[model samples]
Target: MAIKDTSETVDNKLEDKELDKTDLASVTNGAILGRDLTPEEDRRILRKANLHLLPIMAFAYLFQFLDKTALSYTAILGLREDLHLKGEEYGWASAIYYFGYLVATYPIAGVLLVRFPIAKVIAITMFIWGAILMFTALCRNAKDLLTTRFFLGMAETAIAPGLSMIVAMWYKRSEQPLRQGAWFLGNTSAGILGGLVSYGFGHLHLLWGFDDSCFHHGSNLSPRHVRDDRFLTKDGRAQAVARVETNMTGIKNDKWKREQVMEALCDPNAWLLAVAYLASIIPNNGLLTGLGFSVLKTLLINILPSVFQLVFVLISVIGSTYLPNTRLLFMALNVVVSIVGAVMVREVDPVHKWTRVMGCALGVAFTANFPMTMAMVSSNFAGFTKKTTVSAMVFIAYCAGNIIGPHLFFPSEAPGYKSGFLAVMICLAISAVLCIVLRFYLILENKKRDDAGDAIEVPLEGINLSDKTDREIPQFRYIY
Candidate 1:
């Protein structure tokens, strides 16, 4: 006879004054049948959400990556000459985009996502970014390019964190790695697809025009297609919310908690993850292009690395899903592979260009580390505000690294940016070490909880979805 919330209770809790605004209304109201889901029922619901959610997520993310990297592609195809860019102007243009991204991530996440529906915010931002990308086509000088790139960065910043939040909302911890990686393959797809598109346009001497059009068109496509509500019946929506209850991380919470912001800022684990992100992203800043290689060879060289990264990301995420407690371990291993790849790029004789290209492909192994870390945040962090804050901080680190990363490729270095490659190798090593440290820290924290008799497993109904931080929940165990 116990009352519970499910399909019948949808929107009923919105009028309850006693209920915390931070609680998801569909979850806290009481009106539906009370029962635990069977294993088969759980799988059915998961599959449905995956089908409806992931494709749109992946497609949106693919366009985001392409839009962000369009400048780099155009640079190789005469953007520098056409814009009259000089010395470090090109690097500044690249770095300035991230400056807008860094400036916008925290405030935008804190304000817009909390006040508006997440899907709506994402959709609107997508439209804005698409318009901004179209504007990139009209940039006739370095100042114009810099101005357009900055606004584009601000517009696009919402997508990555927004997508991460969506993954946490719909999926469980066990499902997060693969789902996160699946969407992130947008980055890999952009690389491969962008290279092919750029290669085709390069032959026609129309690379910049096509890059702008592709970015704009791709951005505009995602807003109308996100059918999140239509994916499931009313009953299926309840089941989707119910299945993730054991996560103890509530779906969507509008009310911000100042204490949770401080918690996220002070958490040692958050900083560790931030450092890992910072080190890993520095290497992603620049790629060798158009140093005298034919457009065909340049296309091959650009695409080969993305293909290799695609393979490595798939293997790593799948391995994380099937293997127990191997998420951080695999992340560290990929970073090591990247280190070896960086060394190969730096030390290999220039005459052996293909060998260096192979190294470049291997250098991207660390790409998998990012989704792994995002999964860790989704699995480990509780409370919507805290989780969002942590995500913003990590991305700020990401933006900072990207900003600093391009400048490391000194214009004087020309074909072989030895200094830049060396920096890449060092940062990759640091990231690998930090991943190991984080794993140990999580292990120790879990052990302490177990010793304190606070690690008891709870049923789905027994778990608190009241927007508590992981630290406040003694039963919460940190997952590596």
Candidate 2:
């Protein structure tokens, strides 16, 4: 009988040393996964790896945001009147999706994500959600729409946390921010593309002159339409594992550890990140999802804030790359900008419509905190189970924030939702304070660890060979 390592392998993969056959096997099988893969060869192969990996993530995230926010567009287009939604009913519709998201995220991460092939889980969920999105266009009433949307949120609950885990799996720590940025650019990309798509949906017609079906068809077709063929098979997979061994990125923590779970739960900084997420999502999701009800024109509503958001996301991601210890700094600056925008929204004259638009856009721009915070998650934690637990915890905060966010913009607060904007500013302020405290905690911990033999950065091979959690490693420095 084959050993479990070989017996359980889905692709029947062979190690690099085992592939020390002829030169033809190395050439035909893969580029990076061969034996004794060199650094220069690794760099060459990384380009190929990114090509295979990044676009798949970017596309999924792009459409996920687009589909998730499609209801906001539909709100302005006539979803409420058609469905006979009264008062805060639409807010409930918006908020309910996150409830399903909250319920499903942890179980899925613990069970499906931890126990199965990640790429397969991601792809299957994308397909499942795509099908759910199609059912959205067929809903006849609030109940039907809510049913489809709640399931949609449940399926999508896997992507963000799953993507974060995959990022750690594939890239080195330093490469993570930019790669995450590139995929996360899909957020702003969704803003720009989704806004334009939504605008087009409202104004234009397609397929025998029925325009509304476009959203239904578009959401379904877009995901299923583009198939990612990068997943390897047979010996190709063996070569990929060779490349992975070069990074030692696949060290397993398969056995359950009660202590790891306890450590994750007890950490104060974990609570701080969760609180920050809870507070931040309230305002950001409120502004992002329900902005249609404001005085802004539909075209501008779709486009302008996204323009600001796109620029800021790009800037912050790039800035984080060059500026050391600047994640908290950029987060603080975003909060300042958001607070100013809130003040602008409150104090500005009603007649100056664009000024108010600018204020809202500035407020929405604070979404850069998302990528920054997630980067914090990936860089700060280690070990499979612990990191998954942290991701589940933070996203629960995410679901709570989003669930509460919509309700803050009641029908009573129409046109100028003073209370809504004020609440967001307060949330941003709270998040900013949390960022500082988290940074300070990280700094203090690094100082305490410095006395041990943790000075120089150790190779991934060293770390992975031991399968040490960040908590277990004396030298594991938390990235700010």
Candidate 3:
């Protein structure tokens, strides 16, 4: 726990022939070295980190969600008509975004995020996407819309992986779920904001276009203008690094390890998490529902699900922090709720409108599970390369699910979209089962590590802060 004592521990291990010199040499030179913080100082550092970091991330995430789902709101305001969208062209437009997302996730996450300064990379991507959002206003046809959305998808891919890594860098393993949920609230709450924005600007033609173009332009530029070290002092940065030492997940490491990438590809937990993500996102795409009502009623109705999602996400993630080893448990429960909601939406009579509206609200409850899975990635993965690689794999599955989601909503099905709803039920069920499977897998892994008599104390001696993957760190424990 003492940074000064860490050198003595390293020296003793070296003299005892217990520590490899290569491991010492491979540690990043940028690693923050400092004294152990007081409990009060730890809390103070956390508060400062949260205040400075979370708001910027949350704001950027809000705009990202808003711009991405703008097509949904705009479709209601005649985006289809404006672009002269044909039968399945609108669905293709929605699906195409993920095609770009799927294409770009690997290089950006596995390479770009690793090779560059994290904050600067995030800022540049946000600015590029914001400009793409502006160009969206100028699109005269479906082709232009698809082109812009593709690049927009590519640009916006940085936020989730980057922010998750930031959380992993700054927060403790126990603190990650709440922090991840906090920023992700931007995504859920964007529904309410998008509703209000669409309602206010729907009737106005040029103003709506201008708002989309200029608002994003202004918001995205703010990050680049801000200094990177504005919040933390020199000593505070070291304490911040010291804070997450027990996490067993190292911070930034510029040198990419090919073996780590291969390990990530072979990791059962990574594939399990990826499958859960794939299942959840397929249903997420079909959650938006509307009745044939006035704009005000439609706005109010649409806002209901966002409200539902917000409440559920808060309850689940906040609850995870207090309850030990229940992150995946809560995730499964969220998916179960969505399955029940999907059933209600599919089975309830069309005449029972309010009931179906409530069903629609419940149908999206599973959105809460996403942040938990992200929390798993942040808390569970160790090596920076493996973490980013696993994240890219999971997001690739996410993109694939999203790409397939819209196409499931056959135009012939119209308002019912029975096939899409059916797919939602199936995917939700699969996701719930996978959550339980992942939980059990982690439990078994932890048991094996314990039974093998790994040196749980070695991690305390500074080994945890090394650029070693979880597989190489026998002392590392998985958080379920």
Candidate 4:
């Protein structure tokens, strides 16, 4: 198909009748301007673009999750016994992984994602971390395992946030929740895959198997090789490029604006979201890895939660796609369920082991809000640097929570970590409240934007390729 001449197509529309910023709010949710996108044309470009984007993203993320969670799998597969891990050393090992991620993500995103193509950067990191995963096989002691895990964490740190920026680059704000759900599904997929892999370790030793390390070939998914722009005729390239330009997201804006960073820092919503994220992760991060090893201590039971979570993830994605503004609603609801699950896991009597196990499964279903939050980050934030900065901050919180999470479950707690459960319950309660607060705050902000008359006295012509901050752009509307 030929590239749709968005410039010419839009020129006539702009000249005939311009869309005011009031309509820009509609545009923020993926409305088309004039007749620039016929129904058929819109579907065609979107199908083509998503066809190009989703598969690689899912595959890369699958391995990223699998590689990270492989450490957890190793727990059931004899890692602790093999490494002679006593008490808090395993906790330290778990915590150190995110510690590496915490320190690495900021500089990597600031320097690398801003400068080079994100696909290249993702590829480089995937390979490096895969090598690190392979290196994990060589660790003979707890110290060696800790070192390897830390570097592996560092290698994988930028991936989720970087991919968030990439999805924003390609898809509109409205479609992001669905697309983000599609990619983030990889985490669930990894959980399932890790379960199966751990099962393999239980039955047939999977160590050093050629295919065991899916990371070796995960890097082969270079965008050039997959969604090759070269294969697209000149017209197609123009259409694709115009879509990005229209989206007001440039592929590369070399200069990092200080004001954008400052705006992100000043944005209270960013902090609220970050804190909510941190709270949500603490219950689920470190303890999640040990659930199977601790409770049932059986390989099949360990893998079962992932299966249930995969179902939950799919259900949440479909719910978001159909329901529109109910993302936060589902988030709060999921956390409430998770809190019930936490209590069950902590307090179930010996006769009700199965009930407790079911509760544990339900509690970890809090993955619902993550895709929503990532989509929120992309939809709400404008300006490349500001968005990136916010993305970085979110990951910083993610890293911190994951890092601190393991420590909450002390070795003293053994099979039932009461303190850990209580801590998670409190954080999750806080997160649930924050979810409502964030939703209300955005609703108020949107109402105020409507009152302000959503018209930019002077809007930019095509795209804000200059990377203007959302605060600088009065016409911009933040999406909930």
Predicted model with the maximum lDDT: 3
Residue-level lDDT tens digits of model 4 in 1-480: 432334553444345332333223223323222224446756666787677678778877877777777666677667789889997787788778888888888778756776566677787777678677777887889889889888988998767877787778667767888888888888777776667657755422234223334543554454531124443554454344445445553334555667778889999888888888888877656434334335225555666667767766677767866887777777788888889888888897635667766887888777767787788787778776778888888888888777767668776776678888899899999999998998898888867777888455435444444456666665666665
Q: List per-candidate RMSD values in Å.
A: 3.8, 7.0, 3.9, 5.6
After aligning candidate 3 to the native by TM-score, how far in Å is the CA of 219 from where it should be? 8.7
Off by over 4 Å in 1: 1-19, 22-24, 28-34, 202-228, 290-292, 454-464
Q: Give TM per candidate.
A: 0.90, 0.81, 0.90, 0.86
Judge candidate 2 against the unseen true structure and give its global Cα lDDT, from 0 to 1: 0.65
TM-score of 4: 0.86
Model 2 CA deviation exceeding 4 Å by range:
1-39, 202-256, 287-296, 453-462
Cα lDDT tens digits, model 2, 221-313, are 222101112444444444344554433323234444556668889987678877876776677564433343442356447677778877778
Q: Clash number for every model?
A: 0, 1, 0, 2
Residue-wise C-alpha lDDT for candidate 3, range 328-348, written one tens digit per residue: 999999989988988887787
Worst-scoring 10-residue span by lDDT in model 3: 219-228
What residue runs in model 4 are displaced by over 4 Å at the alpha carbon?
A: 1-35, 202-221, 224-231, 243-251, 286-297, 454-456
